[model samples]
Target chain A: MTTGTASARTRLDPARRRTQLLDLGVGLLATRTLDELTIDLLAERAGISRGLLYHYFGGKHAFHEAVVRRAVEDLVAQTAPPAGGEPLERLLASMTSYVDYVTANYEGYASIVRAAQGGHEALRRLHEQARNVLTDRIFTEDAQGAVIPDTPATRLAVRGWSAMTEELVLTWAADPGPVTRDQLLAAVTGSLPALVDLLR
Target chain B: MTTGTASARTRLDPARRRTQLLDLGVGLLATRTLDELTIDLLAERAGISRGLLYHYFGGKHAFHEAVVRRAVEDLVAQTAPPAGGEPLERLLASMTSYVDYVTANYEGYASIVRAAQGGHEALRRLHEQARNVLTDRIFTEDAQGAVIPDTPATRLAVRGWSAMTEELVLTWAADPGPVTRDQLLAAVTGSLPALVDLLR
Candidate 1:
């Protein structure tokens, strides 16, 4: 029986094992901050040895970067705007989706925010990528149309608007009662026209 | 002569010693992140014994909190609006001071910004205090006068605006001249009236 169990574990493909580990990481992030994550604890939880975990991630920092990157990718996927709508309608849809994603995945949102502020190089790159994608969607093209010409000022405005949206969503997620989701969505999207005007 | 040197070091008052240690920390922050700071390095830089440094700060975390608090206080003082001006003028003056402070003290600004994102409890509190003071000045009363009523929405707007301002200043500090300081200042303050309008 012991030999059979060992053989089954060893037979797990590397890709499958990696995915399993990453899924465990995502689950753990729901309850723990990235800073609090440890390889030993994860290994124990997975019923594997620390050596096996390190074989997959090399170290805690590497594992953390992977987790952060995955989270950011997930966020981008979750918030992607649907096809074929008016620009304003698309913008509003995107904003609502963003708030919904944040509220539903508070831990992932928190992790991304925390990592964006002077985290490791990979994590920071992932953060910038996420921001750029959102900015591109909002400024370069939207469902309604290409609303703004891509200029330096437009880029700055988009980035600023992105930052504002993030801060508002984070605040709302932490305490939902103070402001309803609709109010939060309205506040964020309503401010965009003014932001575009300022950029112009 | 050795005894004399030792005696002179020991003769430094506790208040003076604490100040000396904190000043070293401030200097180190110019080149290192707060998490990178160490008592051993500080003691060596200050030509004090490790025990003496520990005497002033029980641990590295405590020392970091003290340094962050001091930096935040210094930032508040540096950015305080000059007394008795129109609200718009006062707001602009305050914004200019903020930009100047951030440009001159990039490291400190970075540290404060980083700390505001999931740092120690004390550092986070100090950051909120700094933000509150700035937000209050902007929303409650200035030379121009109280432009917005103090409501939940108003508070949210002020906070969102503050975060936007911080992100802009930090970006400008990293690479100046793409947007002139005046442009950055104008961008931030110009967006505020609109934000207030949106909130209303």
Candidate 2:
């Protein structure tokens, strides 16, 4: 019985080790570029056997994808609009939420962003998910006359507005300067009326 | 006399070797992530001895920085505002120029963008140089607007506008939809007066 218990403990150790490896790999990704990350380096950092590392993740690409997926989920969760605000207010709140998310989790956010450059299907899905949320907010806002638009114009307007919000969040993350959260929120809000009219 | 001739060839070789290394490194960077970029690989790609590579670039960081700086200068040169046009026309023309530049050279542009996240001082300087050019255009357009106040609000407005423009360009490059060049130009032009008002 004692011998059997010893074997079970040994088996469970590897599974625990694998989980630890995934966590470390994902955590490091936030701070380092994808290309800079190496399996040997990751194994060393995670205190795992390189052979076992391969068993757990298959390879670096798979590991990186997992990290990216988590970031996408996090970003979507962080920026989801409030339930009962006016359309414009909801949009503004969502934009500010995104900025705050970027500021606080820049490492993870940046990694996912860099990984998304390629036509990675998972990343694309994540992007489309975010776009859909923004689109809903824009449509609601437009219906309220907070954002003016016909279909084509409104679609273009939201696209442009999102384009700006995404870019500013990225820039502020890259360099935290006098461009405060308040500044970015105001700037995005300021553009909404023009965005609505442009759509019309 | 033979020794002297050999010395002259050796002296000339270093600069030629450095240029060759930069060419190879830059070419790879256009398509690959910085983490994937390695000195051993770069030396092999350049067909130079590792010793010669060190002699030219000092190390990987310096080499990466130089490649980034070269890419930035090229982008700035390509997208510099057209020599003369109306403020709105000039803005649209510059956006068109930007679209052309990125479409033609996105790999290099993407690489520079990746480098920006590192937030190295040199990278920050490159970003500032690019921003200054865009800011100048914003100022030019805003000058004609009698109502737009030249205050902190105006600065934030211009910065936000530029951020949006940059974001849309990057996104379009990543995913070119039905919004053709003419359509994009018209939408942006239609929205300009509202953008001007938001600053005021």
Candidate 3:
């Protein structure tokens, strides 16, 4: 960063600086896994010091959580089903956005996955919260008032679908090999209805 | 206590002692997560000293890997598709065995999944090796020769299917909720052919 941005860090109000730090953290997640992101690195990247970084988020883990939460919120928004549409069309659209967003933010998405699978409590909650949002959209009916019954069994199937989508999207994004984007999306979205139908 | 099993730890040969240690580790996984199975706990359970534990496996990580490898090997064998049958029947049988094995070995299965997602290199490799063993079986032909052609696309689909199965099986096993065992099994097995059929 130029001296202009670096030295101007202290000029911002406390809340703005915190948000700035988190935004910088999210940006770093573009290239770094959550595990690799240390407070020292964030401090250096932001042209600030470690003590000041801790002053904002209190600790490294908390800072990681805040950045992860922001990224997941963006992802949840990106993949939300449209307000009005046929259910299947909305699902397909959502899946398309999901694949596009994850591919674009491959490293961040991967970091979130790793954090969730790790022993981190806050990240685990964020990961599940993000997932539940996406899974809820699969059954949420804007005008029709829920076409799928939203029972425990159906919920289980939907969670499975989410897992399937995550795995395929990440694996394909990393190395799509012979699998085209369209085919991948088709396989992911195509199997959901089939899976839910079995529950019914 | 009779003290027979506890004292015998010092009497066994090295190979037998290593196997005994590994087997004890596997048994502990029945009730505890891989994360929870500390070297201290294993040493205490085996009625042996931590120094001896390190002597056998060199360190805690290596010990965990060996124990996990043994557990995953058992899972791989348990879920192996039967040698001969109609494709769908063999698939169903495999799914049944898959669910049965995971439910029985729920803690170990969860640990393997968590370890695979975590940064642990060896466990991740073992997890993939076990998964590949299972996924490859989906295409392996015992007598009629390979049937699925095993393209990159199909392999991707199968991997996604495996992810789906893992999520569903783990979720369902934790709490079947209103879903019956048969329903869970069907939801998992029924979707595979549909997913594969989409490729054709």
Per-candidate Cα RMSD to the true structure, in Å, reads 5.1, 8.3, 4.0
Better of 2 and 3 by lDDT: 3
* Model 3 lDDT per residue over A1-200, tens place: 42576466557778887887888888888777887788988989988789998888988788888999989888888887777678777877888999998888888788789768756778888898888877776666533534466777778878988898898899989897767788887888788778888876
Best by lDDT: 3
Error of 1 at B150 (Å): 1.0
**Candidate 1 structure quality by residue, lDDT tens digits, B88-169:** 7777888898888777778766876776665356776778888888887775564233666677776787778888888877
Per-residue lDDT over A1-200 for candidate 2, one digit per residue giving the tens place of the 0 to 100 score: 32686575456665676666666766676667656667887878866578777787787777666556655666677777788766668778877888887777676666565455333556656666766765665666457564555465456567777766665567667775645667667666767666655435
Against the true structure, candidate 3 reaches a TM-score of 0.88
TM-score, model 2 to reference? 0.57
Q: For this target, which candidate reaches the highest TM-score against the unseen true structure?
A: 3
Candidate 1's DockQ is: 0.35
CA lDDT, candidate 2, residue A187: 67
Interface Cα RMSD in Å, per prediction:
2.3, 5.1, 1.5
DockQ of every candidate structure: 0.35, 0.17, 0.62
Give the Å shift of residue A138 in candidate 2. Answer: 4.0
The per-candidate TM-score of the B chain, in the order shown, comes to 0.86, 0.73, 0.88
